[model samples]
Target: MGSIVLTHLKSAWHVDQAILDDEEKIVVLRFGKTTDAAVMAMDEHLSKIADRVQNFASIYVVDNKEVPDFNAMYELYDACTVMFFFRNKHILVDCGTGNNNKINFSIADKQDLIDIIEVVYRGARKGKGLVVSPKDYATQMKY
Candidate 1:
C-alpha cells in the first residue's frame, strides 16, 4: 500500500506549487489515473521509496483525468508517466528508451526506481538538465 502514503495532487496549481516550493528535493510527479494497472504498479514503487528518498526527492501523484491541466502540456497520455522537476525546471533522463521526458512504463522493481531517482537527484544538483540513467531501461521497458 505505498499509494496510501503518497500525496495526491488534484489540481494543476498544487502541482505547480509542489515543484516550485521544493528547493532542495527533486519533485517527482507521477501523472496518471489511480485506476490504471500500470499507474498502480508505479505507485507501489514510489511509495516504497517515499521515506527512503525524502531527503533528496519529494514524490506526488497526480490523477491526469481529474486535473487534465497538464495532460496536453506534458503529453501525459501513457498509462503511467513519471516526471522529475528541479527548481521548477523539468529534468530529463536518458533512459536509453528514446523517450527521455519521463518514465512511461511501470518499473517492476523498487530498487530500480530508487536508482533512477538517485541519478536524477545527483544530476539536478550539479546543474545538469539531463543525466544518463544508471541502467539501460530500453530492454527492461516494453511499453
Candidate 2:
C-alpha cells in the first residue's frame, strides 16, 4: 500500500496511494475542506475504516496542482468532498444527499473495494471499457 498528500483550494488532504499492487488497483480516498480541522477529522475517520479492513491501502489529499500521470474520473466541483477511485473508475458510494460535498459509500464495507478491483480487472482483461454515463461518454461516440 502507498499514499500521497495533495493540496487543492488551500486545503490539505491525505488520500490513498495510487499504485497497482498484484493486479489490485489502489483505492483513492480524497478529502477536501476549507478548514484544516475538518479535513483532519475526515482523514481520521477514513483511517479507522482502513484499519478495520486490513487490506493493502494508501491515502492522499487533493490540491490545486494536477497530479502527474494521474487521471481524473470524476470531479466534485463544490465544497469539501471525498472521492474514491479504483482502476480509473469512480466507486459510486451513497452518502445520503448524493451531492458532491460529502463523503458517501454505498458498498457497505472494505470487501466492496476488493469486489470493485476484481470487476474492473476482469473487465480490462476482456477489453471492456469501464461503464460511464451517456453524457460522460458522448465525446467517445462522436469519434
User: TM-score for all predictions?
Assistant: 0.96, 0.43
lDDT of 1 by residue, 83-103 (tens): 999999999999999999998
Off by over 4 Å in 2: 1-26, 33-35, 54-57, 64-79, 100-143
Which residue ranges in model 1 land beyond 4 Å of their true spot?
none
Best by lDDT: 1
lDDT for each residue of candidate 2 in 1-143, tens digit (9 for 90 to 100): 11222323222222322423323443544544424444555444555455533344334556423332222334544333455455544544332343422243233244444444344444444555442211221122100
TM-score for candidate 2, residues paired by index: 0.43
- Candidate 1 global CA lDDT score: 0.91
lDDT values, one for every candidate: 0.91, 0.39
For residue 42, model 1's alpha carbon misses the true position, in angstroms, by 0.9
Instruction: Single out the weakest 10-residue window by summed lDDT for candidate 2.
Output: 134-143
Candidate with best TM-score: 1
